[model samples]
Target: MLQKILRIPWIARRTNHNILQELGMKESQLLKNIKQLKLKYFGHVVRHNNLERLCLEGAVEGRRGRGRPRRRWTQDISDWLGFSVREASILSQDRDGFRSAVWEATSYSYKDPP
Candidate 1:
Protein backbone atom coordinates (compact mmCIF):
# COMPACT_ATOMS: atom_id res chain seq x y z
CA MET A 1 0.00 0.00 0.00
CA LEU A 2 2.79 2.42 0.86
CA GLN A 3 4.53 1.67 -2.41
CA LYS A 4 1.34 2.13 -4.40
CA ILE A 5 0.58 5.34 -2.52
CA LEU A 6 4.03 6.68 -3.42
CA ARG A 7 3.70 5.60 -7.09
CA ILE A 8 6.28 2.92 -6.67
CA PRO A 9 5.32 0.15 -9.03
CA TRP A 10 5.04 -3.35 -7.60
CA ILE A 11 7.40 -4.60 -10.30
CA ALA A 12 10.32 -2.76 -8.77
CA ARG A 13 13.13 -4.82 -7.26
CA ARG A 14 13.32 -2.97 -3.95
CA THR A 15 12.45 -4.76 -0.73
CA ASN A 16 9.39 -3.77 1.30
CA HIS A 17 11.52 -2.15 3.98
CA ASN A 18 13.53 -0.21 1.43
CA ILE A 19 10.40 1.21 -0.16
CA LEU A 20 9.02 2.31 3.21
CA GLN A 21 12.35 3.82 4.15
CA GLU A 22 12.40 5.87 0.97
CA LEU A 23 8.94 7.14 1.84
CA GLY A 24 10.17 8.21 5.30
CA MET A 25 7.90 5.69 7.03
CA LYS A 26 9.39 3.38 9.60
CA GLU A 27 8.12 -0.20 9.39
CA SER A 28 8.68 -0.55 13.11
CA GLN A 29 6.23 2.29 13.71
CA LEU A 30 3.57 0.39 11.78
CA LEU A 31 4.37 -2.75 13.70
CA LYS A 32 4.08 -0.86 16.98
CA ASN A 33 0.73 0.57 15.97
CA ILE A 34 -0.59 -2.89 15.06
CA LYS A 35 0.59 -4.30 18.38
CA GLN A 36 -1.01 -1.47 20.31
CA LEU A 37 -4.31 -1.94 18.51
CA LYS A 38 -4.31 -5.68 19.08
CA LEU A 39 -3.56 -5.35 22.79
CA LYS A 40 -6.15 -2.62 23.28
CA TYR A 41 -8.86 -4.50 21.45
CA PHE A 42 -8.28 -7.81 23.22
CA GLY A 43 -7.91 -6.21 26.62
CA HIS A 44 -11.24 -4.39 26.38
CA VAL A 45 -14.44 -6.06 27.74
CA VAL A 46 -17.07 -4.91 25.29
CA ARG A 47 -19.54 -7.55 24.12
CA HIS A 48 -18.71 -7.18 20.45
CA ASN A 49 -15.01 -7.25 21.14
CA ASN A 50 -15.39 -10.43 23.15
CA LEU A 51 -17.44 -11.98 20.39
CA GLU A 52 -14.93 -11.07 17.73
CA ARG A 53 -12.09 -12.45 19.79
CA LEU A 54 -13.99 -15.62 20.42
CA CYS A 55 -14.61 -16.02 16.72
CA LEU A 56 -10.95 -15.55 15.96
CA GLU A 57 -10.03 -18.06 18.66
CA GLY A 58 -12.56 -20.50 17.23
CA ALA A 59 -14.37 -20.91 20.56
CA VAL A 60 -17.79 -20.69 18.88
CA GLU A 61 -19.13 -23.90 17.36
CA GLY A 62 -21.20 -23.90 14.20
CA ARG A 63 -22.04 -25.85 11.04
CA ARG A 64 -19.82 -25.64 7.96
CA GLY A 65 -20.86 -23.85 4.76
CA ARG A 66 -19.23 -25.45 1.74
CA GLY A 67 -16.00 -26.64 0.06
CA ARG A 68 -12.59 -26.02 1.59
CA PRO A 69 -12.63 -24.05 4.83
CA ARG A 70 -11.67 -20.44 4.63
CA ARG A 71 -8.36 -19.46 6.10
CA ARG A 72 -8.75 -18.83 9.82
CA TRP A 73 -7.46 -15.90 11.83
CA THR A 74 -5.63 -18.24 14.18
CA GLN A 75 -4.12 -20.04 11.20
CA ASP A 76 -2.71 -16.82 9.86
CA ILE A 77 -1.20 -15.96 13.23
CA SER A 78 0.09 -19.48 13.70
CA ASP A 79 1.63 -19.44 10.21
CA TRP A 80 3.48 -16.35 11.29
CA LEU A 81 4.63 -18.14 14.43
CA GLY A 82 5.66 -21.22 12.36
CA PHE A 83 3.36 -23.39 14.46
CA SER A 84 -0.20 -24.65 14.88
CA VAL A 85 -3.38 -22.74 15.70
CA ARG A 86 -3.89 -24.84 18.80
CA GLU A 87 -0.52 -23.73 20.13
CA ALA A 88 -1.28 -20.16 19.17
CA SER A 89 -4.56 -20.32 21.08
CA ILE A 90 -2.72 -21.67 24.10
CA LEU A 91 -0.12 -18.93 23.93
CA SER A 92 -2.77 -16.25 23.56
CA GLN A 93 -3.59 -16.90 27.25
CA ASP A 94 -0.36 -15.16 28.18
CA ARG A 95 -0.33 -11.42 27.38
CA ASP A 96 3.40 -11.34 26.83
CA GLY A 97 3.35 -14.47 24.69
CA PHE A 98 0.62 -13.05 22.51
CA ARG A 99 2.62 -9.92 21.95
CA SER A 100 5.74 -11.86 21.04
CA ALA A 101 3.81 -14.09 18.67
CA VAL A 102 2.30 -11.07 16.96
CA TRP A 103 5.72 -9.49 16.58
CA GLU A 104 7.11 -12.67 15.17
CA ALA A 105 4.21 -13.05 12.79
CA THR A 106 4.54 -9.46 11.59
CA SER A 107 8.25 -9.82 11.03
CA TYR A 108 7.57 -12.88 8.84
CA SER A 109 4.40 -11.84 6.98
CA TYR A 110 4.74 -8.07 7.03
CA LYS A 111 5.34 -7.88 3.30
CA ASP A 112 2.16 -9.76 2.54
CA PRO A 113 -0.69 -7.89 4.15
CA PRO A 114 -3.81 -9.96 4.77
Candidate 2:
Protein backbone atom coordinates (compact mmCIF):
# COMPACT_ATOMS: atom_id res chain seq x y z
CA MET A 1 0.00 0.00 0.00
CA LEU A 2 2.76 2.44 0.94
CA GLN A 3 4.76 1.19 -2.01
CA LYS A 4 1.89 2.02 -4.32
CA ILE A 5 1.75 5.58 -3.07
CA LEU A 6 5.52 5.94 -3.38
CA ARG A 7 5.41 4.97 -7.03
CA ILE A 8 3.32 7.93 -8.01
CA PRO A 9 5.22 11.08 -9.07
CA TRP A 10 2.84 13.52 -7.44
CA ILE A 11 0.26 12.09 -5.12
CA ALA A 12 -2.34 14.68 -4.18
CA ARG A 13 -5.04 14.58 -1.51
CA ARG A 14 -7.42 13.29 -4.13
CA THR A 15 -5.00 10.51 -4.97
CA ASN A 16 -4.87 9.51 -1.33
CA HIS A 17 -8.66 9.52 -1.21
CA ASN A 18 -8.82 7.15 -4.15
CA ILE A 19 -6.15 4.92 -2.62
CA LEU A 20 -8.02 4.77 0.66
CA GLN A 21 -11.19 3.92 -1.20
CA GLU A 22 -9.47 1.04 -2.97
CA LEU A 23 -7.73 -0.27 0.16
CA GLY A 24 -10.81 -0.04 2.37
CA MET A 25 -8.86 1.95 4.92
CA LYS A 26 -9.33 5.48 6.18
CA GLU A 27 -6.84 8.14 5.18
CA SER A 28 -6.32 8.98 8.81
CA GLN A 29 -5.27 5.41 9.55
CA LEU A 30 -2.70 5.44 6.77
CA LEU A 31 -1.42 8.81 7.90
CA LYS A 32 -1.14 7.53 11.46
CA ASN A 33 0.94 4.60 10.30
CA ILE A 34 3.22 6.85 8.28
CA LYS A 35 3.70 9.13 11.27
CA GLN A 36 4.47 6.17 13.50
CA LEU A 37 7.00 4.77 11.06
CA LYS A 38 8.63 8.15 10.66
CA LEU A 39 8.93 8.59 14.40
CA LYS A 40 10.34 5.12 14.89
CA TYR A 41 12.94 5.41 12.13
CA PHE A 42 13.65 9.14 11.93
CA GLY A 43 13.08 10.29 15.50
CA HIS A 44 12.38 13.96 16.30
CA VAL A 45 14.19 15.13 13.16
CA VAL A 46 11.07 14.21 11.25
CA ARG A 47 9.18 16.89 13.19
CA HIS A 48 11.65 19.69 12.43
CA ASN A 49 10.41 22.80 10.62
CA ASN A 50 13.07 22.55 7.89
CA LEU A 51 11.99 19.03 7.04
CA GLU A 52 8.38 20.19 6.88
CA ARG A 53 9.22 22.88 4.34
CA LEU A 54 11.29 20.46 2.25
CA CYS A 55 8.46 17.94 2.31
CA LEU A 56 5.85 20.49 1.29
CA GLU A 57 7.96 21.89 -1.50
CA GLY A 58 9.06 18.50 -2.85
CA ALA A 59 5.68 16.86 -2.69
CA VAL A 60 3.31 19.49 -4.00
CA GLU A 61 2.85 22.24 -6.54
CA GLY A 62 0.04 24.79 -6.74
CA ARG A 63 -1.91 25.50 -9.88
CA ARG A 64 -2.06 28.99 -11.29
CA GLY A 65 -5.35 29.77 -9.52
CA ARG A 66 -5.53 27.00 -6.96
CA GLY A 67 -5.98 27.81 -3.28
CA ARG A 68 -2.86 25.92 -2.24
CA PRO A 69 -0.53 23.19 -3.39
CA ARG A 70 -1.03 19.60 -2.38
CA ARG A 71 1.70 17.47 -0.81
CA ARG A 72 2.94 14.50 -2.80
CA TRP A 73 3.66 11.43 -0.70
CA THR A 74 6.70 10.68 -2.88
CA GLN A 75 8.37 13.78 -1.52
CA ASP A 76 8.87 12.07 1.81
CA ILE A 77 12.28 10.53 2.48
CA SER A 78 10.83 7.13 3.31
CA ASP A 79 9.27 6.97 -0.12
CA TRP A 80 12.27 8.41 -1.97
CA LEU A 81 14.83 6.35 -0.07
CA GLY A 82 13.60 3.17 -1.64
CA PHE A 83 14.48 4.50 -5.09
CA SER A 84 17.62 6.23 -3.88
CA VAL A 85 19.07 3.00 -2.52
CA ARG A 86 18.68 1.30 -5.84
CA GLU A 87 20.24 4.18 -7.70
CA ALA A 88 23.05 4.48 -5.21
CA SER A 89 23.86 0.81 -5.56
CA ILE A 90 24.10 1.18 -9.32
CA LEU A 91 26.31 4.26 -9.08
CA SER A 92 28.70 3.16 -6.38
CA GLN A 93 30.62 0.06 -5.33
CA ASP A 94 29.74 -0.06 -1.65
CA ARG A 95 27.95 1.89 1.06
CA ASP A 96 31.25 2.99 2.61
CA GLY A 97 32.42 4.24 -0.74
CA PHE A 98 29.25 6.27 -1.12
CA ARG A 99 29.65 7.68 2.36
CA SER A 100 33.23 8.72 1.66
CA ALA A 101 32.22 10.30 -1.59
CA VAL A 102 29.47 12.23 0.11
CA TRP A 103 31.85 13.49 2.79
CA GLU A 104 34.34 14.61 0.15
CA ALA A 105 31.67 16.25 -2.00
CA THR A 106 30.19 18.15 0.92
CA SER A 107 33.49 18.83 2.72
CA TYR A 108 31.95 17.54 5.95
CA SER A 109 33.71 15.60 8.68
CA TYR A 110 32.82 14.27 12.09
CA LYS A 111 34.91 14.86 15.21
CA ASP A 112 34.99 12.61 18.25
CA PRO A 113 33.50 14.08 21.41
CA PRO A 114 36.07 15.39 23.84
Candidate 3:
Protein backbone atom coordinates (compact mmCIF):
# COMPACT_ATOMS: atom_id res chain seq x y z
CA MET A 1 0.00 0.00 0.00
CA LEU A 2 2.75 2.41 0.91
CA GLN A 3 4.79 1.62 -2.15
CA LYS A 4 1.89 2.44 -4.43
CA ILE A 5 1.43 5.71 -2.61
CA LEU A 6 5.13 6.55 -2.80
CA ARG A 7 5.45 5.45 -6.45
CA ILE A 8 8.49 3.34 -5.61
CA PRO A 9 9.17 0.94 -8.46
CA TRP A 10 8.44 -2.62 -7.48
CA ILE A 11 11.51 -3.96 -9.27
CA ALA A 12 13.92 -1.43 -7.88
CA ARG A 13 15.04 -3.90 -5.18
CA ARG A 14 15.62 -1.11 -2.73
CA THR A 15 15.87 -0.96 1.02
CA ASN A 16 15.70 1.47 3.96
CA HIS A 17 12.07 1.98 2.99
CA ASN A 18 10.26 4.45 5.29
CA ILE A 19 7.00 5.21 3.49
CA LEU A 20 5.18 6.73 6.48
CA GLN A 21 7.79 9.41 7.07
CA GLU A 22 8.03 10.17 3.36
CA LEU A 23 4.35 11.00 3.34
CA GLY A 24 4.81 13.34 6.33
CA MET A 25 3.10 10.90 8.61
CA LYS A 26 4.32 9.91 12.03
CA GLU A 27 5.50 6.41 12.69
CA SER A 28 3.30 4.37 14.98
CA GLN A 29 3.03 5.77 18.52
CA LEU A 30 3.99 2.38 19.88
CA LEU A 31 7.39 2.69 18.26
CA LYS A 32 7.89 6.03 19.96
CA ASN A 33 6.96 4.46 23.28
CA ILE A 34 9.37 1.60 22.74
CA LYS A 35 12.15 3.99 21.84
CA GLN A 36 11.49 6.12 24.88
CA LEU A 37 11.46 3.07 27.13
CA LYS A 38 14.66 1.69 25.69
CA LEU A 39 16.47 4.98 26.10
CA LYS A 40 15.26 5.42 29.66
CA TYR A 41 16.01 1.85 30.66
CA PHE A 42 19.53 2.05 29.34
CA GLY A 43 20.12 5.33 31.10
CA HIS A 44 18.62 4.67 34.49
CA VAL A 45 20.16 6.84 37.16
CA VAL A 46 20.20 4.09 39.76
CA ARG A 47 20.08 0.34 40.05
CA HIS A 48 16.42 -0.57 39.65
CA ASN A 49 16.63 -4.38 39.74
CA ASN A 50 15.14 -4.46 36.27
CA LEU A 51 15.63 -7.60 34.21
CA GLU A 52 15.51 -5.61 31.01
CA ARG A 53 18.62 -3.68 32.00
CA LEU A 54 20.63 -6.82 32.40
CA CYS A 55 19.17 -8.42 29.29
CA LEU A 56 19.89 -5.40 27.18
CA GLU A 57 23.42 -5.00 28.50
CA GLY A 58 24.40 -8.60 28.98
CA ALA A 59 26.23 -10.78 26.44
CA VAL A 60 24.97 -14.32 26.03
CA GLU A 61 27.58 -17.07 25.99
CA GLY A 62 27.93 -20.31 24.03
CA ARG A 63 26.20 -19.17 20.92
CA ARG A 64 26.27 -21.46 17.87
CA GLY A 65 24.62 -20.66 14.60
CA ARG A 66 24.80 -22.18 11.17
CA GLY A 67 23.72 -19.09 9.28
CA ARG A 68 23.12 -15.46 10.24
CA PRO A 69 23.03 -14.60 13.91
CA ARG A 70 19.97 -13.24 15.64
CA ARG A 71 19.35 -9.55 15.48
CA ARG A 72 19.85 -7.92 18.89
CA TRP A 73 17.80 -5.11 20.34
CA THR A 74 20.95 -3.29 21.36
CA GLN A 75 22.25 -3.45 17.82
CA ASP A 76 18.98 -2.12 16.50
CA ILE A 77 19.01 0.71 19.03
CA SER A 78 22.53 1.62 18.07
CA ASP A 79 21.62 1.59 14.41
CA TRP A 80 18.56 3.70 15.10
CA LEU A 81 20.63 6.27 16.94
CA GLY A 82 23.57 6.11 14.52
CA PHE A 83 25.76 5.67 17.56
CA SER A 84 28.11 3.22 19.12
CA VAL A 85 26.84 1.40 22.18
CA ARG A 86 28.90 3.64 24.42
CA GLU A 87 27.78 6.73 22.62
CA ALA A 88 24.20 5.62 22.69
CA SER A 89 24.46 5.02 26.42
CA ILE A 90 25.76 8.51 26.89
CA LEU A 91 23.13 10.14 24.74
CA SER A 92 20.26 8.17 26.23
CA GLN A 93 20.83 10.09 29.46
CA ASP A 94 19.25 13.17 27.98
CA ARG A 95 15.54 12.34 27.82
CA ASP A 96 14.35 15.31 25.79
CA GLY A 97 17.13 15.15 23.23
CA PHE A 98 16.82 11.39 22.95
CA ARG A 99 13.08 11.66 22.36
CA SER A 100 13.63 13.97 19.45
CA ALA A 101 16.32 11.70 18.09
CA VAL A 102 13.97 8.75 18.34
CA TRP A 103 11.37 10.66 16.33
CA GLU A 104 13.99 11.30 13.67
CA ALA A 105 15.24 7.74 13.69
CA THR A 106 11.86 6.01 13.45
CA SER A 107 11.72 7.49 9.97
CA TYR A 108 14.54 5.23 8.82
CA SER A 109 13.22 2.12 7.10
CA TYR A 110 16.27 -0.08 7.27
CA LYS A 111 15.31 -3.73 7.11
CA ASP A 112 15.89 -5.50 10.40
CA PRO A 113 19.03 -7.60 11.05
CA PRO A 114 21.06 -5.64 8.54
Best by TM-score: 3
lDDT of 1: 0.61
- The clash count for each model shown is 0, 1, 0
Ordered by lDDT, highest first, the candidates read 3, 1, 2
CA-lDDT, candidates in order: 0.61, 0.45, 0.64
TM-score of 1: 0.42
CA deviation > 4 Å runs, candidate 3: 1-49, 107-114
- Across 1-114, the per-residue lDDT of candidate 3 in tens digits comes to 567666789786554345555566545544666776775555563134467666766776996778898787678778767888777666766767766776677555565332
Q: Please write out the lDDT profile of model 2 over residues 48-88, one tens digit for every residue.
A: 45765355335235645567756544345435244353353
**Per-candidate TM-score against the hidden true structure:** 0.42, 0.27, 0.50
**TM-score result, candidate 3:** 0.50
TM-score order of candidates, top first = 3, 1, 2
Q: In candidate 1, residue 10 scores what lDDT?
A: 68
Residue 21 accuracy (lDDT) in model 1: 73
